[model samples]
Each structure stands twice: as C-alpha cells, then as structure tokens.
Target chain A: MTSISIIGTGKMGSAIAEVAARAGADIQIIRRRAGAGSSLERGDAEYGLVGDQLTGELVVLAVPYEAYPSVLGHYRDRLDGKIVIDISNPIDFTTYDELLVPADSSTAVELSQALPAGARVVKAFNVNLGDTLSTGTNGTTTTTVLFAGDDPAAKIAVADLIEAAGLRAVDAGPLSRARELEAMGFLQIVLAAIGKTRYESGFALLQ
Target chain B: MTSISIIGTGKMGSAIAEVAARAGADIQIIRRRAGAGSSLERGDAEYGLVGDQLTGELVVLAVPYEAYPSVLGHYRDRLDGKIVIDISNPIDFTTYDELLVPADSSTAVELSQALPAGARVVKAFNVNLGDTLSTGTNGTTTTTVLFAGDDPAAKIAVADLIEAAGLRAVDAGPLSRARELEAMGFLQIVLAAIGKTRYESGFALLQ
Candidate 1:
C-alpha cells in the first residue's frame, strides 16, 4: 500500500484523509498537538506530532495558504526528499473577489520555493471542494482532479492516488501551470459562495 | 426579433453571428469597412461599416483585446446607450502563461470604464470557445455561457440571447465578477493549447 502523511485536521485535511484511507493507503495524521481528536481516528491511521520524523513517501500540506510559511518553517528539514502536494487556494477572504498571491505566481509555486531543496511540490485537490473530494463525484460524472508538478514521477504518483480514490486526474503540464489551476479554484469558490451552482457543483470538461 | 450587431469579422464574431442568426435574431455584421466579405454573409445577416450609425439594441465586440482601444475610440458615440458584450480574453500571448490585465482588473471592467457613460458592458461568451459557442454543446452537455454585469436588465438581455442560441446562461453576480470569468477563460484557453483538453471541450457545472 502507498504511504501518505497528511498535516492539519481541518475539513479539507480530514476529507482527503478519509479518501486516502478508503483507497487503502497507509495513512498517517500529523496534528499540532498530540491526542487531538481527528476524523482519521475512525480509519486505520496512525497519529503523530508536527515535529515528528517524516515516514511517508508523500506528504500532503492540507493547511490554509496563509499557514504554509509557518508550517514549512516548523518542518523544513523533515520534508526533504518528500513529494509535497499543495491543495491550498490562496483566495482573499476580505474582498472574496481576488487571490492573495501575485498574478504570475501561485500558492504551490511559492510553497515550492520556500520548501527544502530536495522536496518536490505538486499542486492537486485545490479545485475540488471538501464535500466533493470526500464523495469523489458530483452525481453524474467523476470529479476531475487537475494536478501540476515539475517531476514526472511525482505527478504520476499523485495521479495514481487520485485514481485509486475514485477521481479522474488531469495532468495540467508543468508546475508553472499551477497559476491557472489556482485561478480555476478561486472562480469555483466564488461561484459557489454566490449560489450560482451551490457548493455541491464540480467542473466537468465535456469533449 | 432581437436585433444584434456584431463588430469585427473574426472567428468569434462570425460564430456568434451564426448562432444569433439560427436563433431568429435580426443580425448585422459590422466590419472596419463596408462591403468587406464576412463569414456571417453565409448566414442571413446584413453587412455594414464600423462608422455606420448603430441601430441594434445589443452590440457584441468580438475583436481582439488589443483592438478594443482603436475600435471603441472610433465608435464611442454610436455605442452610447447600447449594451456592449465583451468577448475578449486579455491573455498574454507572448508568454501564454499569464493574463495581460492587472490582477485587480479585467478586460470587461476596463472596457466599461473607457466606454460612453450610458453604455452597459456585460462580460459574456468569453469563457466559451468559438466552435463550442457555435454548436452550443460539447458531446453530452449544453455549453454554459457565464455572464457578469452590473445592470440586471442588460445581463438578462444577454442571458436571453444565450438561451435562445441553445446555451445555458449562468449569472455570475455583478460586473466585478468578470475578473473571475476572464480568469476562467484564460485557464481554459491555456488548457486547450497544452492538450490537457482539446478546444472542442466546454465547461459543465455538474450538480
């Protein structure tokens, strides 16, 4: 079984953890403090601390965009040589009309630059909502999970995980394409908040 | 019948004209010069000049983003009190990696600021590819036409035309929301170019 470590026990983190566990991955949950109850407890997953030694081949940063800097700073050394998957959408909450990152950059790109030299950063799962990710489908079609990373092997690994979890994986070129992926996420979130498609909607590319 | 004037004889202009013509709208094709051949002539549409007096209730600007300054400058008076639909995605083709407009602004919003005071600018059809707009469907699902504008009446008029053309019109809140719509357009265009999804694809919000 594939080993996966997920940080943060928020809605997105818990949802992704559930999906990974159901996919039969060896799941590990890392929390800020020990004994903190998590939704992962119901599954056969182990718990660890933020400062614990990393064991999983892939580590998912499921925290918000703002918390990335602090979280990476806390575990920078341990994350070396690990494939890091960024699922944060850096949306501006105050205005809710714009993204917090610069136009040319994305949360994934910025996180990649800040991480240790050996870590590989891949962007995935940002486009799907928590509820949608848990279900892996939006009624009729499978939820499309678009991912971007510089490493081909790393992308394939992420894509395999997505497929095993019952979702479709679309490789959106190199890591530079993360800007567009985050933009798509921002638009989807805004549309949902305004009651256009509600939060239950997912994007399907009809050919 | 709803009268519609399409400026510029490009692929988008001609495709929209075909859709409007099929929908039983009284269509007029406005070129830079009179008697200039247009694909729209293949349909039951009249040809006119850019300097000609504007008679249509709705004028669709299907020109490139770079041509908007020159075209809008020449016909500023004629476009007054007319509903202008911006279908240009101000993408930075030089890089094909980012949008040319400022992070806080969009092509539609910028065009609205430069237009005559009474002219209403609604961002529509920018998210749909020209071929997709012409067909109004991508294999299984009806193509969604997402429109955003400050004036409720103007948005409804555009939405009605979209529905009449056999597409689904999604109201994405006010004019400020055009930023997100354009971002969506930019992402879709880039995805098509990279072979992630062919240009034949259309966005479907699966509930």
Candidate 2:
C-alpha cells in the first residue's frame, strides 16, 4: 500500500483526496483549519508537521502558485528522497494576460531549483480543473494526465497517482515542457468561456 | 439580411461558416479550393477564391497569424467603412515556450493600425476552438463568446453573430483586452499537454 499525503484541502485538494481515498491509497490530508475533509489530525502537511518527513513516496502540493515558496521553505528540509509534485500554474490573476513567472522559466522549474539538492519536484495536475476530476470514465474519452520532471523515478510515482485516479498518464518530456503545459491552461480558459468544454476537458495526444 | 464574408477556409473558418449557415446568415467563403463543405452552390452562401479585397458589412479574417500582414495588405483598400473582425492569435509555434508578439502590443492592435480609418476592427472568436463549435447547446451549459473592439457598434455586430451561433456574447471591455484574450490561446496550449482541459475553455466575467 503506497502511503500518500496531500497538502491544501480546497476544491482541488479535496478532490484529489476523495479520488485517492476511493482508489484505496492510504490517503492523508492536511489543511489550515480542522474540518470535515481534513486529511490528518495534526497540523499542516509540511515536512515538520509529521515526525518523519521523507517517509512518504509522494507529496502532492495542491496549494496556490503564490504560496509555493512558503510551502517549499517550510518543507524543504524534510523533502529529501521523496517526490515533490508542483501542481500550481503561476498565473498573474491581476492582469490575467501575463504569466507571473519569468518568460524563460516556469513555476515548476523554479521550484526544482529551490528544492533540496536531491529533492525531486515534478510538474503535474496544474492543467486539470478540480470540478471535472472524475474517477469513472465518460464514454471513450479517457482523461489525459501530463507530468514532467528531471527525476524519472519521481515522474513515475506521480504518473502512478494519476493512473490510480482512473486517467491515462502522459510523460510530457522534461521540466522545460512545464512551460508549454502551463500555457496550455489558456486553451481551457477559452473552452470554458464557451461552455463547450470542462476544466476536466482533456485532449488526445496524436503523434 | 447581413452580408458576411469569411476571409479564410481553414478549420476555424469552416466551423464558423457551418455555424453561420445554420443560423440563417448569408456567408461568402473566400478559399483557394471549392470542396464538399464549400458553400458555393448554396446560393445563400458565396464562394470566392479571391481574398477580402472587396468587402461588405462584415469581414472576418481567419487567416494564420503569420499571414496577417499579407491578408491585411490584400484587403486594406476594400476594408474601408467595413466591420473587420480579427480572429487570429499570434502564437509562436516554433518556440512553444515564448510569445512572438511584443509585450507592449498585440496582433489585434497591429491589425487595427493597418486598417483604414473608416474600417472598424473588432477582436473576437480567437479563443474558441473549432472542435467545440456545435450549433446546439451542451445540455444546460450555455456557450459564452467573448468580443473586444474600440468601436461599440462593431462589437455589437460581432456579438449579434455570436448569439446567433447559440452562444452568449460577452463584451470583454476595450480593444486592449484583445491582448488578454490573445494570450488566452497560449494558456490553452499549456493545458492541452496535460490533456485535462479543452480548447474552448474560458472564464465567465461576472459582476
């Protein structure tokens, strides 16, 4: 049984927990406040929140892009030998036109640089909408989950989580691909405006 | 009956034609070839191999981003006093990570400057995907179409067409909003790799 812990229990955080729980993973959640959808009976899901930090195989950071630095800083010490999945898309909500991160670098790439020397931070789940995360298939349209990271092992672990959620996992090359993946959200915004597609609306990768 | 001419016959151009034809509009398609989907013989719809050199009340430029200058050059003379709709997003496909258009200006702005003083250029429909453009509603979800223009009258005309296509026309403010709307496609590209969202995605502007 793979033990998994999810930080941030908002819509996406809760949805991930619900799906992971249903999939029979030892799901644990940590939130700012103690509530119904809470994962653990302790403090936050940071590294120091638990006695052991690097015990779990995977840690899904479902927090906002703005809070990434603080989250990483608080948990960096304990993230060694574990996969850190960054699912936040650094969008400048103020303008909604410009990306907050530098043009040359993506939020995921920046996070990788900030993490511990051996800590693996993979980009995943930033593209999918929280509303449409369904474990069951909707006809022939199987959901596509994209992930990217320098560490192959970490990428595989994250991919397994996506597969466990009943969606197909696609390895979208290296960490640089995160830039493209992050920009991909713009497409969803367009489709979402027309009510023709859903946040969970995904594409079939044709080579 | 409003006389509308589509300046390109690509996937997006054809999809718009299909919607326009279904909505009982007089559509003139300007394409290089006449084919099955061509509306040449419909009598209601006209087919012209020539570009938008001579235009009517509405002229939709559905050409690729790079072909904008040539298209504008070809049609600039006839575009005077006409309502020109720009549906092109300046996407740098070569460098998937970067935007080709300068940070200060957008493609729509460039086109606006290129057009005659009398011609009204409105930026609309660039964010919509050809795949999700169906005549009917997707169950209870209503389609939201976005439009932006310096001229209110031009915006209204484009909005009217959007409504005829079974979607709600939203005024995304002034022509500068085109920059935000154009950047939206790049964001969509990022989401596509993740395969969790669709091309027609957009956000609702609420009070």
Best by DockQ, which number?
1
What is the DockQ for all candidates, taken in turn? 0.59, 0.10
For model 2, the DockQ equals 0.10
Docking tier of model 1: it is medium
Candidate 1 vs. true structure, TM-score: 0.90
**Top candidate when judged by lDDT against the true structure:** 1
Worst 10 residues of 1 chain B by lDDT: B34-43
Local lDDT at B116 for model 2: 87
Model 1 Cα shift for residue B70 (angstroms): 2.9
Q: Candidate 2 regions off by >4 Å?
A: A28-54, A77-81, A91-99, A103-105, A116-118, A134-153, A168-207, B31-42, B47-53, B77-81, B89-99, B102-106, B113-123, B127-153, B167-207
Candidate 1 deviant stretches above 4 angstroms = A35-37, B33-37
How would you encode candidate 2's per-residue C-alpha lDDT over A75-187 as one tens digit per residue?
77777777887877777766555567875677888988887788888988776666545443322345556677888888887777777777767776688767666755544
Candidate 1 residue lDDT tens string, B1-207: 588998889889988887787677888888976666544565477778887776679999988999888887788777889999999899989988677788778898998999888999999988888887888776567778888999888998888888888888888778887877887788788778877667777566654
lDDT of 1 by residue, A1-207 (tens): 588998888888888887787678888888867766444575478888887876788899988888887787788877888999999999999988778898778888888888887999999988888887788776467777889999998999899888888888888778987877887788788778877665666566554
lDDT of 1: 0.82
How far residue B34's Cα lies from its native spot in candidate 1, in Å, is 5.4
**Clash pairs for candidate 1:** none
